[model samples]
Target: MNYFGIIRPAMVTCLMLMLYLAIVVVSLITGPSGLDPQLLSGFSLSPVTGDSEMANVIVTWLLLPRTLMALLCGAALGAAGVLIQGATRNPFASPATLGVNAGAMLAIVLGSVFLPQFTGQFPVVVAFSGAILTTILVFRLAQAISDSPVNLVLIGMAMTLSLGALSAGMLMFYENRLDGLYTWGAGNLSQFDYQPIQRSWPIIGMLTALALLFARRLDMIELGTEQAESLGVNVRRTVGLSLLIAVLLSSTVVSQVGMISFVGLIAPHIARGLGCRKVWLRLLVSTAVGALLLLVADVAARLIPLLISDSHYSFPAGVMTTVVGAPFMLFLLTQRKRVSALATTPGETGIQALFHLSPVTFLSALAFVFLLIFGFSLFGNLDLQWINLRWPRVLSAAFAGAALGVSGLVLQTLTRNPLSSPDVSGLTTTGVLFVVLGLVLFPGLGSLEMTLLSIMGSGFALLLLLGLSRLTGFNPLLFALAGLCLSAMAATLISMVLVLGSNQSSEVLVWLSGSTYAVTSERFYLLFISVLAVLPLLFAMWRRLDILQLGEYLPSLLGVRIQATVAILLVMVALLSAVSVAAVGGISFIGLMAPHICRVTGLSSHRHLIPATAMMGSILLVGSDWLSRTVIAPFEIPSGLLVSGAGGIYFILLLLSGKYIQRR
Candidate 1:
């Protein structure tokens, strides 16, 4: 309304745009060629005269294509985000929410794994298909449930997780085929020919036209469905059009670049803050902001190593954007209390009973999971029909499953966050890194030492989570965003270590997925001790945890030392997570879904929730392991990957069934 407001936002927009362009220029110059800064600066003034073929090729071919690709992809994603959050009125919505990215990922993964001949061109088509399917799934799922903007978002998240897991598992089934897909999954924008963007440009253009045409409807609808309807807007038709355009704009971009996080969340908010009022202005501003944000992230991804000599770091644009966007969003959330996304409410109070076990049913379910796991493990690539039966293999799968199951229980109990899991939190991966570091630094160290180091990593991760929670108000969605960011960071670091030109450390990647390749009686004994130790501790703290779950204040009045109890439980969770990580690889999401399964099965009490979560986790891991090993014999998938695949479905099912509202 004020002159200063108009001038300030315009100035900020101009400044950010200028800064973004400069970064792109800088990123275009930086690469793995080890080009010195002086040479690049010199080359800038020098026109294309291919005198030095290598330098010319690097600059003209590689750098130029890459930079342009980054700019386009970034802008597309950023605009996509703005369209989504604005259209849905949910901050949590992103390309990933609507399944666009994951569906695209699934298509690309399938191309690599199942259809090798089409690897080059198939990824794009597959990605497009995935994105389209994703939009349909999200809208349909939301329609089937409630059409509240928040419910659509939750459905999108559910679809995303399910599809993403399916994609990962598909890749695993064809890892030998899809070995180098992680970078693509990381949102690599290395090689592009401008053809794909051109193909989708028409769609993007149509979307822009629609957004502008329906600008007034958008402004009216943002008020609320009923309000818009009262104002003579055809709320249903306008929303349907908005949803269609948003999905098309989003998925088309996702088809090119794998899912880039936070672009959508950051862009529109920035655009509006910068004084864009009209729906068309917001969309346009968001488009420019999104493009610049992505370009800057890509450029920075390239620029970081140049700034630091001897640095060997590289990040995909998507990961880098998320890493930057998550904290900024958190800061924004804290500074302003009023929000558009789903709001959290404290849970209802009651005397939640712990005992919900029916001996006949519990045992029956256990038997079923056991029999299925046993049948699969007992008859894998390692045959045993005429030969003597191996007790070790059977026991190994069982124990590992049990470890995960229990780990999930411990984590869910500690956090009181349903989506909380060792896998979801990235503790499993971080813990693995630490354990590996310990093993490498102190050769021939005991299992206990490795486990201890891993627990330290897990504790460090939990502390990081706590600090993040404190800063971000501990919203589950934000926590998930942080976890995604952290996962990318850990993956980037791991990729660096794995490719360090040595087979010795490289081999540890086997455990990156849940595996029992070197299982021993001693290892099992340690796991047994860990499970026994943590179970009783969790049980002891049951009442306090229940009280703590009753929102943050009431526990203190119940004569509980809230801070101390939380600290201890947090440490215990780290211990449990670290031990599991040491035993298996960095499988995530089991902890998140296990607790939900428990709660859904009518065991909300900590006492029952704890044990139930562990059992559900065990069942999931064991079952996934069985599928991994048996379904595709002689080509074993990682147990963790498979569990994630399964758990992703369970997560989606929770959304479809409305169990998500309880957690939400």
Candidate 2:
């Protein structure tokens, strides 16, 4: 049949196959140093010497296997994406989005760290188990709430963050044991031989075939559950089987390549856009598209070094895919038809009755803060030398945390989204990215300069997000998705910098994970002044913020200049987040957690909630700082990492409780 009366399906298929073959040939001929002339000579197993032998070895052992592995893994991920998206009836669904890849990677990291021998023995089993279990958990939790596609993705995102935090923490603490694993974790496809391909292809092939067999059922189910049931399809059974196949396929790929993202997500969309309507046809096209996409990405990864004249530095193909895919996701969000279809129900006004903060509760919070400060100050040694070194660190964490908390509250109020925060909104990542870029481009920048760069980056990111989100009238889900895309792109760029063998990789990693170790007196003072500067403005806007929470219409009716107020508040958030990130790296979730915690305590008035949130944030981070310093003693963990772990768990629980309350 002709597609759109412009192209034939068979012709499209043939074109895709031909393109794939051409790219495969290109991949084989290419290397870090470019094309090899000797590769034109016929293959020889003879004991040839010099260029021919070197070329033969590189082609046969390294380039060929890596290329083939990329094709196989890409095909597997593509098929898996189609399966999950079909089963969930969610266009945004993919193995990465559903937490399968993160789960698998986390499990493998845990096994390798805690049970090295066992992990070394049966790595595949461990990966598969993690992927399946996490998928089940995400699905169950999402099901518990509602079957809204948006909710499923949100829950999956939370799980992915939680799992990722655990994986990062383990790798950081056990860096000695997991050396070079970070490169692999970032998704490496380099191969020394064919063993990985030899072992994994069969499983990948079998899983893809099984997924295809369910294509008809998936198509029926897409007609709606009742319609599918009437058509004699066992909807639940089909979904379960499809998900299982998807997890297995994805985990198999992860076990070999370690978290290649967005292949599954990008491939199916490309196939469908090419007018592949039938489920089976779409699956076939998607698999081919996925393989081709990954092969091209690998080629780009190899060629990047040549482009930059930096032959010594190269990064993972996964980074290349992410850099490409993130923008594509934003493009998808901009499509009016897709945005309308994914439109979410308005968020409920949770816990209407606000209780007064009792004196005991206020005093208890104060006591906790003082105790944490004191403990953090005197935990190791009480000498003057120790105090001189330690006080800066403690105050830095406190001030930075308070800034983040207040920033988060402002963001939530302005966006009218409870989940809104600097980190979640991509402001933190953008700020961190700019600071890292500044450090790379112009090393030895002072604290003030770095903070300026950070604010500039964050403000730019906010403007970009707001511009794109305007197309959808600032719908909360779409806004969040846009921020997510921005964050992913920023993060991928940072990873590219890290993988380029930067001299500051070690320090950057530590700081990126939210270490307070390097915070000096000067840096602490800079953060203190920035936070203090923003407070008076925040206090003046408290009434305006409260009016905003009642929605934009009411605020405008009340004679509040809504646009000016929101613009100013957003600027404050960017400044606050920027300074905090400059001081302590990307300490996340404090902004998210602190605001929610304050709201839960019955403080709805911005007058009361603002300081409460700031206090809560300070206590949380100071306590995290104390634990980070004390837990491993001489070996300090990044306080940001610990907070992220706790925050991820808290975020998930918060989602569940909110859903339950809404149901009630």
Candidate 3:
């Protein structure tokens, strides 16, 4: 018997199946109430028939439903992963990456809010529709952009963040109505009945059957559309059907079990790594792998509360997946070969042919900013208290936005990476985490101490990212990916602190969401000074930045002290990012968005680009702050949320326009 040969096909499959079944049994045994033998008996064909009502209740009501749900959701996501990967021929594609999970979650929330009477299948249908729509939107956006597989994921991420913000806003607006939704949105797996399993299983089973039925066609489609068409495949129909089924499966799981993050992504990759090349085998193996992975995560989620002896701390299963999956995603990114030329450069002639800023245009923009900052008010009547209150908030927004804009401009130019920004570069996130950690550890840490701590953290993060880039042979994508991973880790830490800490402070919540509500005149003064100090140094180095943009080798050959230049600029970025984090608490991507917008709006040179981007940033943030205040008056959304949601959409539009895709 050739264990490695095709005839016998190895014993790995049988072993894996046994392992999965074992895990299922283990999951059933472990619960909030611990293992019960009579519970097992209750689940068996014959009822316990003894004084085992408690055991029967636990099995019938709680343990059986959730364990079964974990298996079903995991299997569904796994099958969805195979279909998505096959359809797109992109290894990184998944429900989370394609914005399907976010869209479905949003749909469920809306359905719950609007159609309270519609139950059972209504949310599933709405979620499925949302997922399909998001998929189509992402596909169209990616098509409009460059053909790089990476673009699909980027656009999807932007869409995901935007949709997430919208859903969060909805949840906030109706928090009383949807009281337990916050926990559920984080992906809870608690089941009091067998309804979710009963509802989700049929849809998942049908999707799995469809995947197996269309396996050959999907396999052919992976060989490129032209080749597939040549091989007598209706390429478009096959691709569309595969994606539709994939989204349906994914959205169904989300509707039933909340937002499980990465099972879909990790499963198919594991199957392929294990040499499951044939489509049917891969689909089955992926499904099994996903089911097993999620079952373990769900078990861990259940056990966490027990371990901590705090049942109030209901750690969602999705957070467990994220804790594992985020690092896995980072590992996959680290494995990519060094690939540079990720940043788009404006043509030399375009940069050289600089236009002077028109006085009228400048003042007009300034006037617009003034009107937005001062003219708008939610409270109809203004008084001395209002004047004092409003100005500081407005100034805080402006200064933070300007700092972000300048930080982004410098980081992008220095790294020569369009994707570089305070948030995406991991600066703001690290800074926020460091400050939050300081709050947890020191207990009585002052605002000033927190600011200094965050600044140091931002500096450390920048240095660490630089070190990673150097080790990775300066691959822009690798730098971006590493930064993204760091950011995810920081975000996870923040979430843990928010959920688990004793304080559970509303002030901290406001800060984490990037609110200006907590910004005092004192804080505004600190931020203003920081911005003023940073801008001058940035202006002085603007010409050097322009010279350096002519490729790395040329700058050094042209007598530029490349190392000194990068160090100084990075310090500047760190300082600016730290201040914004201090003031606004992770107002992200303004740096990414503002500089890109400046270039598109004809401010390509560093001289014009730096100041123009700063001005634009101020306008952007202030306007966002105004909108945040006014959008649903009396119940304000965070300025950070508004900025991020709007900026993410704008960045996607930029990608769709083929503006940011660099031709190397």
Clashes of each: 8, 0, 0
Please give the range of 10 consecutive residues that has the lowest summed lDDT in model 1: 345-354
Between the candidate structures 1 and 3, which one is better when assessed by lDDT?
Answer: 3
lDDT, each prediction = 0.64, 0.82, 0.78
RMSD of each candidate relative to the true structure: 4.7, 2.4, 3.6
Candidate 1 structure quality by residue, lDDT tens digits, 1-664:
6898678877886887688777766766676744445335435555645444455667666677777777676666666766666567776677755567777777767766667677565555566666777787677766754445544554555466556657766665566767767666867667536566566667676667667787788888889889999999998888667766666666566666676767777887787787777777887878778778777777766655546434455567776776676566545545425333454532431222334666446646756766766666555445555113434434555655555655656555444545555666667767876776665455576767767877888878778877876766665545544554455455555544443323455456667666655555566667678877877877777788778777667888889897688778777777777777766657667776666555554565576656655666666666666666666677677777777676666665655565444422
Q: At residue 162, what lDDT does model 3 achieve? A: 68
Q: Model 3 lDDT vs. the true structure?
A: 0.78
What is the RMSD of candidate 1? 4.7
TM-score for each candidate, following the candidate numbering? 0.82, 0.95, 0.89
| Highest TM-score model number | 2
From the highest TM-score down, the ranking of the candidates is 2, 3, 1
lDDT of 3 by residue, 1-664 (tens): 6545853345677778788888777777775565444456656556556646566677778877888888889899999989988988877678987889988988888888987667345778888877888888898887875565665766676577668777876787788988888778778888998877888898899889988988999888877789899999998888889998999898888888788887898999999888889899999989989988888998887777666656556577888887888777766665534123232222321111124455457546755765555466423347877777788888888889889998988887876667678888789989998888777667767668878988988988988888766656665555665676677667766766666664644447667778888787777888889889989989998889998889768888889999888888888889999988988887877988888766755555687777778878888888888888888888788888888778777766665565664545
Worst 10 residues of 3 by lDDT: 345-354
The TM-score, computed over Cα atoms with residue i paired to residue i, of candidate 1 is 0.82
